[model samples]
Target: MCLDVVSRLIGLHKLFLFNFYPYVQRFLQPHQREVTRLMQFVAQASHELVPPDVLEPVLRALVNNFVTERNSSDAMAMGLNAIRELCSRAPLVMNQDLLQDLVQYKNYREKSVMMAARALLHLYRVNLPTLLHKRDRGRPTEASIELKVKQYGETDAKDYVPGAEALVNDKGKKKTKEPAEPTEDNSDSDSWVDISDNEGDFEIDTDSEDDDDDDVSLTVLNNIIVTDKHISQEVSCVQVLLGKY
Candidate 1:
């Protein structure tokens, strides 16, 4: 509930940082009760809207208090998980050196710690690959390399909505010229129908035999239409009788 509220109300994020983060940092010890929950809150609150400068200190505290070698494997794993969550939301808060150092734990002896570190590394590689070392960054595409990271309070001021470019029309655009109407002279040349030059040699039929076939076809069509109308009327009568009309 608190997470949902903080995420929805951007203003509340600052209050969370000013009030809750400091308290979490103060009690961020292995022996402290709810230390994990405190760290979780801090991580969950690290949204992209919050300035990286403000969140960096909290990230530093998490690293120093729990992610160091001095802490147990469990503590390190929890800290890494929290850091991963934080970075996933606001990766700009983390610096290159810190990120490189964190990724080194992918080779850690503890399996849980190792997995947590890999997850963090994976998150950065996907979102902010430039921050990771070249070797650890993996094969980023040309488009991914060109991806611009959004700064705090930065707005993308596009003139038009994306995917709607084709719908937009320029002012004073000239209308397309329609083709000129074909004259009698050009009609035969332009027409798609292939006319043989020797067409006058063949005898032309004034009355087509197909005229009788067309009349028969019309009669058949009328019969079909009448039969369909009768069937529909019968179905409607049945539906009305069954109170389903």
Candidate 2:
């Protein structure tokens, strides 16, 4: 974990230890979760793992790798974040070449990398004596929108002439009428006709004069009856009729 050991590891060309750049968060992905445990361990023990002497060289290697070798935008972003962390933690370790690389990276095609580069540049400005004017030019600012308008833009309102008229076709014009929609009354002989039943013939009464009509109730019923002892009932009815008379 010490700087001397990390430096020796970096020197070993066959090992390619610098390939595991922190800029891309997926550096440990190729290792299939094995490198993740080691990264976590290093993070937890970063103070004890990497000594002051090794920090600069390790950061330099990381910056150089991302700037040259790593093609992934994500990795470049992560590396830029790591550079910022290193600059904040130990600004003196950041060299001029590293600062210039970050500045150049501000225009990276990947938005994440550009943002990270801008952040790293800001940190560099604080830690080192970078030009102040480059800060605004390095990354877009709120004023850029207005500045762009000032450069190559126009307003929605333009100077108008009082007598201007829209173009009209006057050559070989013919008089034409649009077909009218068929009404429910079917008054027009050329109008559309319905083939179905006369349900469409019903008129919607909009006249308010019929609103005063009284309400009416109507009901109809049918009934059926059967009898077998009709003679006894007829005799009883005749006797009662004679007594009443």
Candidate 3:
């Protein structure tokens, strides 16, 4: 529980790795009692927030001390399990050569050890397949190949709603119609006014002003239509780039 809380903190993970990890590494030997529980604790403490360089030594020590051929079958299985848990949380700590070597233990004599090795192989096969030997890597789908590993402190570059441009265009069209309706109603009422001899010049002036208003309205509507088309084209291009068809 303490490890669970401490590992969630930002800078404290590095401190835990530096001060506490080496002490746990010492007890990973075959003769040590409750070594399995100690290894589990070590795995729980590891997280992606910690740099791979800091965690690499701990993985190497576990492999060298417990997963070796000289260790008993139980010790080897425990070591492989610990490594799997560690990698599941922070796979960047493992190098290609080390991962390739560990996956080869799938053919170990003991069933428990073999299963543990195979589980490790399966985990990487889905996540970091390039680390495994080609034969062991198997066929990956296009989406799987495109999967990107998130590095420590890395954040997404683009954070926006999809189809937002379309929404904006829709709202703009609604706003343009609202002001246009009132102008149209006023123009219709003005067209019904009675004209006399003295009002003839006034009627002519009113007609000229209406013509000017019509031209301005046409210009505004044309611009809005062109803008809508441009926004639609941009949205289509973005969809194509993202493979949305």
Q: Give the TM-scores of the predictions, in the order they appear.
A: 0.58, 0.36, 0.58
Q: Which segments of model 1 are wrong by more than 4 Å?
A: 1-17, 157-245
Candidate 2 residue pairs in backbone clash: 1-49, 23-75, 23-78, 23-79, 24-75
The weakest ten consecutive residues by lDDT in model 3 span 7-16
The CA lDDT at 189 in model 3 is: 88
**In candidate 1, which residue pairs clash?**
none
lDDT of 2 by residue, 172-206 (tens): 13334558977767767556566657878767777
Per-residue C-alpha lDDT of model 3 across residues 1-245, encoded as one tens digit per residue:
56445544523344444666776777777788777777777777777666788778889888998899887898899889999999997888999999988888999889999999999999988887878887897654443454565667565453333344676566668778444445876888877867666754663335555664422344555566556556656665675457653
Residue 130 of model 2: what lDDT? 40
> How many clashes show up per model?
0, 5, 0
Total clashes for model 2: 5
lDDT of 3: 0.74
Report each candidate's C-alpha RMSD, comma-separated, in the order given. Answer: 23.3, 35.2, 20.0
Highest-scoring model, lDDT: 3
Q: How many residue pairs in model 3 have overlapping backbones? A: 0
lDDT of 2 at 104: 85
